[model samples]
Target: MRTGLLLTTLALGLSTTALPASAETLHLFGPFKDEHGATAPIKGSASAMLDTTKNTLTYRFEDNGLSGPVTAAHLHGPAADGQDAGVLAPIDGPYTTRMTGTLQLTPEQVKEVQAGQSYINLHTEKYPDGEARAQLTTDLTGHKHHME
Candidate 1:
């Protein structure tokens, strides 16, 4: 009886181990090049910690080189260059050069963001409307995502 109990426990443990691990973090990098009026386009990197279980994303951005003060920043819907869409989260920045924020996403928001339906953009004083932008898409193509 004891042997059977031990085997049962071992089987349960093995089954649990086979469960897929949740994705807790995502590293995203791309360039932000907009000739519309940017200082000359800048490259930036972003890292996000996603609480997939909770549907939240905390991200940080580092714009290695850029000019002028940031006027506005936001996470937008997934779309290519010259495409327009609504905002996902309003980043609390336009501060200094680098920006970071912890954003809580609703179920629908999480679904969209995970589906490669989100991008980030920064507006500068010189380009009050918006000068730099980067769209996030699946890396299945093995091509580096770019910020345009």
Candidate 2:
């Protein structure tokens, strides 16, 4: 547990030499599930470091057992759980099993992300709508919201 916490701290650019409560970063993460009407044999994970100060979100994402190669990836939201919304940002990718990129969040996007109203959606040939999806629901740093 200590190791995990320390690793998370380091990953988020937090240093012990910094002042207490200096969390300008938020870690948003979750695993992909076949819920939200997705109907493919996909499983995966998504994680991101949201630097609120810069309104930039750096993402680390991976997926496995997808029905087909990824056709598109996006950050979709401003919607509630079990609800579907339009894409807010395109996820940069090699569009394979693993991908990473950075997104410059608009003010509205930042607000929505902070409110847990955002999700990662990977579209595939088998399911052009979506293969599997994951919601970025909380700040692991405990600086803001908590995942349920």
Candidate 3:
């Protein structure tokens, strides 16, 4: 009986260790540029963290020396760098030097983000096309599940 109990306890411990974590944290960052197929002096940077289990994204961004007031911002994707696509998520702002927020994403959106095809873009009064843009890439500095 004592041996049987010890074996059962060991088995339980092994099983628990093999269980997957409930949530995963993913990080992304980018450097912005003019992606409207034009040349501009505008510049910016952005970073974000996604909690896969909660389907929430927390992001912060900053820009400087834009030619005009920022009219809009968004996460746009399913396209490669230098390519343009429709907005995936709109970011509310008369943007300041820094902006931050947390947003919930649909399962489909999350999939697109994880696929490395999404980008952040800032539209300005002078460049209704988009004065600054950044392609978001997975940080990969920590553990992340393979999206395959």
Candidate 4:
């Protein structure tokens, strides 16, 4: 038991140093089950990093296992429910669902994320519009783990 505890502590310490607290990632997951009250399968994972010193947000996203072809994808503003009323980052590609980009946040934008105000959405061919979406919430507790 003592050996196990020691190993666990050592692992945690090493990982914490590898991924500093200030540079830790915000793991985000959302299953886009529906859009406009219709059933759809939109599954994806994203990693978000907020540079407090620079007030910027760097995002790395990927959405595969989609029901249909990808049309467009983007980051959006806050909403109680998942919807496309807000779009922040636009993915670059055609017939592809993967996205990667960095969004320079304004002071107001930083406030919005801190206040739980951001989301990611993907559009597909079958939907021809929106298929899946997930909102980003500030993670101070750090319980959210890296997406599987």
Best-matching candidate per TM-score:
3
Show the colliding residue pairs in model 3. Answer: 33-133
Q: What TM-score would every model get versus the actual structure?
A: 0.66, 0.74, 0.75, 0.62
The CA lDDT at 23 in model 1 is: 47
lDDT (10s digit) by residue, model 4, range 30-54: 3334575446454555667766546
Model 3 bad stretches (over 4 Å) = 1-22, 139-148
Ranking by lDDT: 2, 3, 1, 4
Top lDDT model: 2
Query: Can you give the lDDT of residue 3 in candidate 1?
Result: 100
Tell me the TM-score of model 4: 0.62
Worst 10 residues of 3 by lDDT: 139-148
User: What global local distance difference test value does model 2 have?
Assistant: 0.78
RMSD vs true structure, all candidates? 6.5, 9.3, 8.4, 8.9
Ranking by TM-score: 3, 2, 1, 4
Q: Model 2, range 11-95, lDDT digits (tens) per residue?
A: 6775564535544788788777775455666666788888776788888877888877889899999987568899989987668
For candidate 1, the C-alpha RMSD (Å) to the true structure equals 6.5
Q: All candidates' lDDT scores?
A: 0.66, 0.78, 0.76, 0.61
